[model samples]
Target chain A: MITDRIAVDIKVPNQTRYLCLIGHIGENIARTLRNYSGDREKLAYDLNLVLTEAMANAIQHANEGDPDKEVHIEISIISQRLIIRVFDFGEGFDFKQYVRPGHPLDEHGRGIYLMHSIMDEISYQQTESGHVLKMIKDL
Target chain B: MNLQIEDKGAAVLMAVQEERLDAHNSGELKNHMLKLFEEGKNNLVVDLQAVRFVDSSGLGALVSGFKNASSRNGNLKLSGLQLQVKSMFELTRLHRVFEIYTDSDEALASFQQ
Candidate 1:
């Protein structure tokens, strides 16, 4: 069993094409956790889903699909919890105003909802460079 | 955006050939489904047996297709969802919105009924 914190930082161009690569990285990281007692496959899938959604929000919504911009992602495991932070250069939205769409037919709002549902904690904050969306999950 | 499209007389079956459906190719899917609607083939069955992962963008594309089909007085159904993909639908409560089947055949038959 590993007790020390493990972390990785990645910076990718703000393009949708990189979402798959980041998602796979997150999945592989979850699969390698030595102390987690829950289902590894399920945890891996959830991590992949949250990371992909977070990156999509940054690339599409925050960065507005600007290929020139870049998104920063940091994943760390500490104290039996997984932490993920995604940073973008665009203006952040009002997290408090976010509401799950009442209609299931609405197509554009599920990304934030999915991240919140899968992660144990989620927050968006402004940084000196830009904005960062932080998410955590208990292992 | 690899899809195996088969016209089944009553409805069209579009089997996604990709393992993961995310932001990368979901736009292509949305455009293809929109084109099918424009071509007067509004009833569709999307088989996801080959897809193991789907993110919110992929779900959005399917929702967009469903809305377009509904607006045209047609329908869009789904079939062969893997476990993780199925869980995503349930999490977003989209499973209640779209008619799902165990296989493409069943989804096609639903169009007949």
Candidate 2:
């Protein structure tokens, strides 16, 4: 495992169009990890999914789909672990209150569930300026 | 949001041409499916061979289409899911809800049977 930490921070307007681009960036970054022992493709997919989901939530729900606002994303690899943080300047919600939808036919409410399932640790914190969602996965 | 629409007699085949189906464009797919349902073409075989990734919004659009089809006594099936996209369905336990096939031909054939 590489001992040096690597990190990338990005800021983008709160727009859905950037979701795919940011997701691909996350996937490419995961693909570059030299010490990750898990399936590289799977890791790439997970990172992409989590990043997309997190960004979507920040852009849509937290930012209230306000294109004027901006969302911040930070991805870091440290000690064989991948950590992701997404920040949005809006009122935060309780992450613990969300659970997987029980109905198979439900058309929504799966983003947070997927993020929790894919990441080892997930939390939402309120900062002085905004809210941040943190997700960590052991690589 | 490019989709190739074909009338297969038994069902309609809508092939998504995008590689990623997420919050950005899932709304368009949902709107297209709703429009098809309004046109009385409910039984659908959505070909996702080109969709390499699908997030919750994309899944939600498919679920919305599935619900709309079921309400009309029709069906909405999926075909040609990439490994990552398939994993999303499985992860959400939606694989059990939607009839999935290896390809569009098989999905359309199932509609005939």
Candidate 3:
């Protein structure tokens, strides 16, 4: 029940160009928490990869590559847990029904799968504003 | 996206000279690979030793290039996958789709076989 904690809050326009910034943010957060628990490089790598995938999904699929739209990112380190929430004002899909088809050559669907693989916990929900993706990792 | 194209006699070794291969620059890689494919250079090997990170968009570019090469009766191979890239391939079971090698030489040698 650790509330009232906000480490980072950012809102970027739904442009692919901003994806790199999100990766850097994730890396910086991991670096800042290097003294706690997990391997620093691995943590940074996972955070960067997961955040990039999540942001890309929001920019490309949720926002539909609309540069005018906005993607909100919230990072919180609550009780030694790193939590990230990405909000998009777009149509949300049924994440439970989606499965990674056995097409190794296919390109698009790997984003969600990678997010799930890297993060400790992942879920999608529809909020009053839009769709929100929540990912958590233990620090 | 930094790329280095080397003519390896029977195969072409295209090494990614960047640290990241994510959505921001994956389109560049895709376009470059397609350009090479259109030039009748189909036997391709993508060296990822220098690439420390690759997101789904990057993976998509490689797959698109693979499909393009396949349509041209040429094959695309992968070599020098760093741990992170290899993990992504394994996570998505893409290791079954692409011909992955330990090194560019091995990948180029496989083109002969």
Candidate 4:
């Protein structure tokens, strides 16, 4: 029989002010998982950077800075992998339709791309309530 | 984020005095840069030595500043990027967009040559 492995779960109001809090949480998670992964500093830095992009999208785009909305985050460790999920309760965009900003001067579109570059795997799923962004890193 | 501005003969150097640049304060940096452009100072050097971390929003602020400076025939260059901050720039492919230097002196000197 296989059992689910749950690590950390948190929900915060959809406010840009909470971004730093998310960063701290991500750093802590990375540090905790470093014991398993044996890459403390790099993993912590990567997670910190990825969380900023993910939470920014949720706070700015998905929830549209609506204070009443909530952003859910879940972290799990399983099978030598660390998984993170960010859930937003708002209309979600199609990730497959995304295109890298053609021009180097483009300012606003690099968040998702940055997320993909650092994480081992990334995918998106639309939930009944809103959407879920799943990211995995090898431990 | 706090910014310290210094007038160095050829270019104005704006040093980011914060340790982290994120959504909470990126807008402040953007607005400050735009304000400098409005004041008729064009050649800009942003010193990021103290900024250890930057997210997409922070990068966006810098891009906006670059565009604003370019619109007025001015230039915006970057210097003193920490390892993680430099990695963020490369990951976003923004390294192609801005001229980055290892130190503020080199970045400031580029404006002359």
Clash list (residue pairs), candidate 4: none
Point out where model 1 deviates above 4 Å: A99-102
Best to worst by lDDT, what's the order? 2, 1, 3, 4
Scanning candidate 3 chain B in windows of ten residues, the lowest lDDT window is B84-93
Q: Pull out the clashing pairs in model 3.
A: none
| Per-residue C-alpha lDDT of model 1 across residues A1-139, encoded as one tens digit per residue | 5574889999999998888899999899888877877888998899889899999889887888889999999999889888999999997676655435446887878888888888889999999888999999888
lDDT of 4 at A79: 67
Alpha-carbon RMSD, candidate 3 = 2.8
Cα error of candidate 3 at position A82, Å: 1.6
Q: Over the full model, what C-alpha lDDT does candidate 4 score relative to the true structure? A: 0.84
lDDT of 2 by residue, B1-113 (tens): 89999999999999999999999999999999999999999899999999989999999999999999999999999999998889889888999999999999999999999
Which ten residues in a row are the worst by lDDT in model 2 chain A? A93-102
Error of 3 at A97 (Å): 3.8
Q: List interface RMSDs for the candidates, in order.
A: 1.0, 0.8, 1.4, 1.4
Candidate with top DockQ is: 2
TM-score of chain B of 1: 0.99
In order, what DockQ does each candidate have?
0.83, 0.89, 0.77, 0.71
Q: How many clashing pairs in candidate 1?
A: 0
TM-score of chain B of each: 0.99, 0.99, 0.97, 0.96
Task: Report the lDDT tens digits of candidate 2 across residue range A28-119.
Answer: 98788767667989988988999999999998888888999999999998888888999999986667666555477788788898899999
Model 4 per-residue lDDT at A72:
93
In angstroms, the error of model 3 at B70 is: 2.8
lDDT of 4 by residue, B45-101 (tens): 999999978888889899999999999999999999998788878777888889999
- Span of 10 residues, lowest total lDDT, candidate 1 chain A: A94-103
